[model samples]
Target: MDGLLLEILTAVGFGVLGAVLFSAIGLVSGTDETATIAPVTLLVVMLGAPPAAILTFWMAAAVSKHMTHAVPTALLGIPGDTLAIPLLQQATAMRNLGAPHIALRKMLAGAVISAFIAVPVAVLFAVILAPFGSYITAAAPWIFLIAAVLIAYFSAGRWSAVAGLVPFTLVIVALQAFTGTQDVKLAVSYFLGIAIGPLVAELFSAASPMEARRMNRSEYREMTLAPDVKGWGGYFPNPFRVLDRFQTRATAIAAAISSATFVFSPVAVTVIAGEAVGARVKHAYHRLTSVLAVRNGVTESTYIAEALIPLIAFGLPLSPVAAGPAAPLFNAPPRFTVDAASGEVNNLHNLLSVPEFLLYGLLAVALASLIAYPFAMNYARQAAVFVSRKISHEAIIGTFVGLVLVIGLWEGGLLAVFVILTVGLVGGLLYRVLGMNTGVQFMGYYAAVLSVPALMRLLT
Candidate 1:
């Protein structure tokens, strides 16, 4: 009993830490989840934190970030992250209408409600799917291939992305083979390279004479701070009261449905959920607000579901979120791994049972609700102003670059560093030229590692 109490307390401590840390990170615009969350979570895993603590930390961080990400989206008219992109249209519309605060509130409210709904629903789905875990693991290679093609086809690049996968996967296979010749194995390098691809591409473009004019900014980017209006008396207002009956219903329904669609891309599900809900509303203002609520709601729901379902059911990085931001949880090398040849696994899936997942999952959500939700609700305008004026985007990008360099060198010295550079440069360019996003790139990585070996064996 004492040991169990200590474990629970430790999980709570980690959950709080994740919530506080990511809440601040969320306020910084353009902080991609894959770049920020994956590395940090990997560090936690590698440090030998308990499995329950790791799960809680990740859940709290993801939930908290989704809540506060609305700050920049609604107030500054810039997306807070990739997932926050789906909320931009409605957010910008609301900003232009002089009701950005209301938009922010609606988004935050939707996120809180949706997160609570998504946890149990996603776990239930995972439970149902758990019986097929063995079958899924056996067919993991083919499933990853099909999922890769489907995800690519649904991406912004569509057919172009699908075609791009072939060469992208080939590049990874080629890199692995080259690295193998040197008796070195690389995984985190590939993930980091892909995660920061766009940043690398932009840096290279900045140095090119041909792109000098386009890269140059004439003046400082101007941003207007939206006025804060407190409608309620307390620090944390009821999310239910913040949203209308219809908006609450829409958010709940969207969240529940999106939780089950964990196999799909989170951004895609978010867009579809908002569109599905928005089409039903007649009033323009109501439609915009409802869509904002549903979209933000889906962001929380899809992220939780994508990460949890795959982790709980198949112990594989099957979903895009699992393959990208949550990749470390599934396969962080010697600490956590998904063996390609045997489909053998040793990770959070085996460490934490279903009941523990449920308990820690809800605990993380509750912690985020207590910390990030109210903090964003009460101090959004101030947070937005500080982030805009005080924060240096370049510094953030450089920090991540330095972190990647340290990790790459630590992993396999110069060989790994070069592999990271090679993958980053090529993947970054492909992302910039084609509409092939990081999600597609991640799927391509999976295909290279999982599907390629399976194919070779079948052919032999």
Candidate 2:
């Protein structure tokens, strides 16, 4: 009983920490989950955090980030993160209509409600899928290959991304082989490189003489601030009250459905869920608000489901969210790992039971609701104003890059740092040029790690 009580306290403490920290990070625009969350969680794991605390921390952070991310999306017309991108159109429309506050409230409300829905629904799905864990693990290589191709096809690049996968996978393979010759094995460097690829690519473009004119900005960018109108009386507004009955129903349905489709890209699921919900409403205003609610709700549900379902069921980094932001939870080596050759695993799946997953997952959501939800609800405008005017994008990028470099150096010294740079520059260019996004590239990394070995064995 004493042990259990301490466990609960630790989980709660970490949950609140994740919530408060990420809530602030979410206020700053363009903080990608993979780049920020993964490294921090990796540090937590490295520091020997209890499994329950780790789970709660990750869950709370993701939920809180999505909730507060709406501040930038709705108020400043800037996406707060990768998942926030899908919510931009409706948010921008709302801002133009002088109702950015409505958009912000609806997004926060939808996220809170959908997070609650997603936890139980995702766990249920995971329970149903758990029985197949061994079979799935046994066929991991082929599954990764197939999943990689499918995800590439589904990416914005379409056939181009699919074709791009071959070279991308080969580059990873070549890098690994070269590193193997020097007795250096690297994983996090590759992940970090891929996560920060876009930034690296942008910096490279800025330095190029040919792109000088395009990269140069003669004047400061201008933005119009929308007036805030408080719709509710208290610090905590009822999510259901913020959204009407039809909207609540649509968000719930979308959250449930997107939770089931956990293996798909979260962004893709978010966009599709919004389109499906938006198409049903007749009035343009109603459609826009409903879509905003559903899309933002999905931003929460999809991340929760994608991270939880794969972690709970198969213990593999199977989903895009799992492979990206949630990677450390599944495969932070020396602490957590999924062995490619033997299909052996030791990570969250072994540490936390299904019941623990559901319990801690809900706890994390509740913590986020109590902390990030209300904070964003009450201070969206202030947060947006501070982020847009005070925060420097370069500082954020440099901070993350420095953090990644430290980790890379810690893991494999100078070799790992170079590997990160190589992969980042190449992957970033591919992502910017061909629309082969991070999700597909992550799958390609898995293919290099899992499928290539299997194919080689078969050939031998």
Candidate 3:
């Protein structure tokens, strides 16, 4: 037991170190999830690290990545990942106003504040709901179905929601069918890339036309603290001034509710629930920022909570985000499976265990904030100057494209390269010509899932 505790602590230290290193990389390179966290975690796991260490490292990397990755999104027009897209409009606005620091401060502050609020809430929910584990397990399929429906409905809307449903169902069916015949595991990332490849390509193409206009000749800057820097004192805009910015009960309630549910994707929650809360507030900017922050908090919290719920309850991975990190922790396959006859899945690995994962997540959040806050507050100007001088957005984009190509090759061999190009063309047309959110492609992914099952049923 003592050894277990020691291992957990060691893992936490490793996590903090990994996060800081990744955060620095994210700031300079504008690379996100795939570039930063996945490879690092995979490497650690391959080294046969203890489960606790791996979990701590995974959560730490995730939390830390968000803290620093938001910098490019908030300061420049470039988004770090799909998760950071919601902040693009607001962050770009701030950047144009030469107050990119404001956007950075808001994102960093909100992340820290949300992490503080969310960790305890998640822990409480996990403890209270632990007793009903079996019941939750029994209802897993129904829960997933409902979650899928809700995500679809909210993402597309009621009338057009069917479009969303069809695609999701098709994807699942296709996946299941393909899995039965041939292994789809090797192609998962490639397929995911194909589904979203067009969107990425479109983004690059769109930026290409304006790239010359947006290029910065300045050097990149490092965040530095003012001589008067203090602990939490530096977090506020004004030390003595308390901004009632996020003081409303409704915002808190919405954030808490979203955190508890953990059903929809972060983007879905931000668009649906975030908009709903924004409509309720008085000041438009205040409401928008507050709701955005709340939504972001809920997204992060729910992601953490939902991952644990499945593992603690039925021992299944409920979401890809969870499975990605959890895979290394348990040394489990990237995919989960159930027996046909018993319909049961084995989830008995106890590497980091449930409580430890929860604690480590909390600790990572706290430690990341403690480190990031001062850097953001005091060194905003320096960081901005340094980044502008040292890094070129064009270089960043080239690096991203190269990485995507490598990932494509890794997933589907050379065939994925053509897949990416085809998708990129379509995505570019949809975004530039139609002005639609790229998320609509998610419908195609779902459709692929559903088609397989329907076909099987018909044939059988």
Against the true structure, candidate 2 reaches a TM-score of 0.97
Tell me how far the alpha carbon of residue 326 in candidate 3 is from the true structure, in angstroms, after superposition. 7.5
CA lDDT, candidate 3, residue 8: 65
In model 2, which regions exceed 4 Å deviation? Answer: none
Model 1 C-alpha lDDT per residue in residues 41-135, reported as the tens digit of each score: 88888888999999999999999999999999999988999999989988998888889989999999999999999999999999999999999
True lDDT of residue 184, candidate 2? 97
Clashes of each: 0, 0, 40
In model 1, what is the error at residue 264, expressed in angstroms? 1.1
Candidate 2 lDDT, tens digit per residue, 1-460?
9999999999999999999999999998888888788878888888899999999999999999999999988888989899999899889999999999999988998999899999999999999999999999999999989989998998989999999999999999999999999999888889888988888888889889998997898888887778877667798999999999999999999999999998888998998999888888999999999999999999999999999999999999899899889998998887898888988889999999999999999999999999999999998888888888787877776787788679889989999999988898999999989999988999999999999999999999
In model 1, the Cα lDDT at residue 105 comes to 90
Please give the TM-score that candidate 3 achieves against the real structure: 0.66
Q: List the residue pairs that clash in candidate 1.
A: none
**How much is 57 displaced in model 2, in angstroms?**
1.1
Runs of candidate 1 exceeding 4 Å displacement: none
Residue-wise C-alpha lDDT for candidate 3, range 41-137, written one tens digit per residue: 6556546666666665666666666666666666555665656777667666655555555556556655666665665666666667667766755
